[model samples]
Target: MMKSILFFLIFSVSAALSAQTLTLTEQQINQHLTTQLGRDFPINLGSWLKAGVRLADIQVALGRQEADKARVSGRAVVILEQGGVRRDWDISGDFSARPRFNSEEGALYLDEFELLGYRLNNQDASGQANFIMPLLLQSLAEYLAQNPVYRLDEQDPLQRQLKESVLGLSISPGQLTLQGLE
Candidate 1:
């Protein structure tokens, strides 16, 4: 018994030591997704925008959409910058679907952004409060992979991970408009 306990203790310590930890709040995760994606997007929408993307608006829309099928109410300005000049590329309206199950209670949902018209690469929505992170991450990852800043064959580490993560998701293609920005 003593040997078994000792073995378990040592195994637990070694496992803990070998683990890499990342603790991120919802806001932080969203912000990271935005920044990482913004760095590699085909267009400099945020830089062109007068105020860039608002975290609060995205969060609220995501939360509301996840919780209930409320009208998505947020706008993203896509700014175009060339030769030191800046212009709006377009405005974006976010959309999400009201979860059938009580996602907020304990259900898990995945790729739940029906408003964008494309399904997330991951189609599992089985838990409450479970779909938003993957949706945001996958969206950013998809954008980055599809749009390369310098047209390089290889992307940055974060971009690669994001892209790989996207492949694992259950996403369907969605469309965004750039006409309104100009």
Candidate 2:
């Protein structure tokens, strides 16, 4: 009886220690981003541009690059008002950024964003598109900086424990894994 109890205790402790890592799937991350971004759509471009933009159909790819980075692509509608006339342009763009973990906040954030490419509905407006891209990127960067791409649920006992420790973040083919740092 004594031997059986000792073995059981050891087994339970080992199991708990091994389960310290949290993994997030690509679909899960995309869903979270879409919901969070949806709240702040039709972002204004400030007085200097006389324009605004809205993003939709956001998608994310993890571990797509040679380095530790994430790729995000989405469709944007740029609304420009000139002489009281409103014109809307459709644009699609891809962006890449490094993923970082904020232990204090128990969240994952994307940092150091880079625009991979952008396409405009009218090729003739390529020059104008170049000018508008920076503004759109700025808006996105600001939003991401303030918002987390994924957050650990403190309600779960394991996740709550994870929130208190430093974690090492890694990207696999289609998932983000956070492992507790010793």
Q: What are the runs in model 1 whose C-alpha is more than 4 Å off?
A: 1-24, 37-40, 43-63, 68-87, 97-112, 116-182
* lDDT (10s digit) by residue, model 2, range 4-89: 99999998788667657878888988988777543434556766556666665678899977458899888767777756867677
| Candidate 2 runs further than 4 Å off | 1-19, 41-46, 122-127
Q: Estimate each model's TM-score.
A: 0.26, 0.77
lDDT accuracy of residue 88 in candidate 1 = 42
Best by TM-score: 2
Cα deviation of 93, candidate 2, in Å = 0.7
The TM-score between candidate 2 and the true structure equals 0.77
Predictions in order: lDDT: 0.32, 0.76
- The lowest-lDDT stretch of 10 consecutive residues in candidate 1 is 173-182
